[model samples]
Target: MVSDTEILAFFRGELSRQVNRKLQTVPLELETLLQDYAPADELPYVISDYSNKYGVDVSALDMRNYFPWENLPLTTRLFKGRNFRASVIANRKPLTVKMFAESARAGRWLYD
Candidate 1:
């Protein structure tokens, strides 16, 4: 499986020709070898903010039953998988797991 960085670099390379004519754009470099990783679907649970905040101890989520917050405990439903839709996460607002957990606990931001 290709690493996310590799995918990003490929995308940049694909766009280089359509970008500014004079400006040179070197693609970002990735040092880690992705061969060790398994296929996306076959991979382990994805320990994203959702997992960290709720203390859900799973790695590499299954894309099939990929309902992020669907079956969580009622009290946690509001917060489970909440991080994915946060403006901070969606808009790339520089949030950490701890901060995200705090925000979720506060029930301040929610997406419809």
Candidate 2:
């Protein structure tokens, strides 16, 4: 059985490599690498909260199933991937796992 730790490790290495290499990529490419960590059907939902308050425009989601990959839970494996929809990020920009996770958690989009 492939342990989750192993999976996480491999992904961690890959992410580190990308960072170390200073590689520039689009959200689509990041979406591709994200597969190493999350199962096809298991990717977290990326909700959009235009404002920082009680309102989520579920009707307009940028990424189909794009959650912040960095917010992954290695132990309990319980990550509520959520992100806000900002003008820059919502557009076609390079996606960061950290930013996505932080935005999602802050916006409380996971509940949706």
Candidate 3:
């Protein structure tokens, strides 16, 4: 995985670089806060949970990240919402939100 510094370096040659550059300058506490973001992978019965959360078509969610090395499917199921209990009941593996976004950025997954 690329470190935050390397990601910033990749975005350095642009006029609108401040957005990406700002991550590097942020205080550790603030960085940790933002990095706490997570994807919705553990949600069991996502097809229904998403209906309750967004009211939009969950199937419409095509933008997803997947780790090629893990052979995980690019899925909308991971973006619905939290269902930790259901996941436990179903015996599903949990995936972090960060990995999902990174996968999309790296083109391991694609939206329709």
lDDT of 3 by residue, 10-98 (tens): 22321121233447532222123211222233332432442343243445333232222123433533553356334532443223333
Ranking of candidates on lDDT, top first? 2, 1, 3
TM-score-better candidate, 2 vs 3: 2
C-alpha lDDT score of every prediction, in listed order: 0.34, 0.35, 0.33
Model 2 spans with C-alpha error above 4 angstroms? 1-33, 45-60, 64-96, 105-112
Q: Rank the candidates by TM-score, best first.
A: 2, 3, 1
Please give each candidate's TM-score: 0.17, 0.23, 0.21
List of clashing residue pairs for candidate 3: 39-97
Clashing pairs in 1: 44-59, 44-60, 45-59, 45-60, 45-61, 46-59, 46-60, 46-61
The CA lDDT at 79 in model 2 is 37
6-39: candidate 2 lDDT, tens digit per residue = 3334334334232324556322232344534334
Among these predictions, the greatest lDDT belongs to 2
Clashes of 3: 1
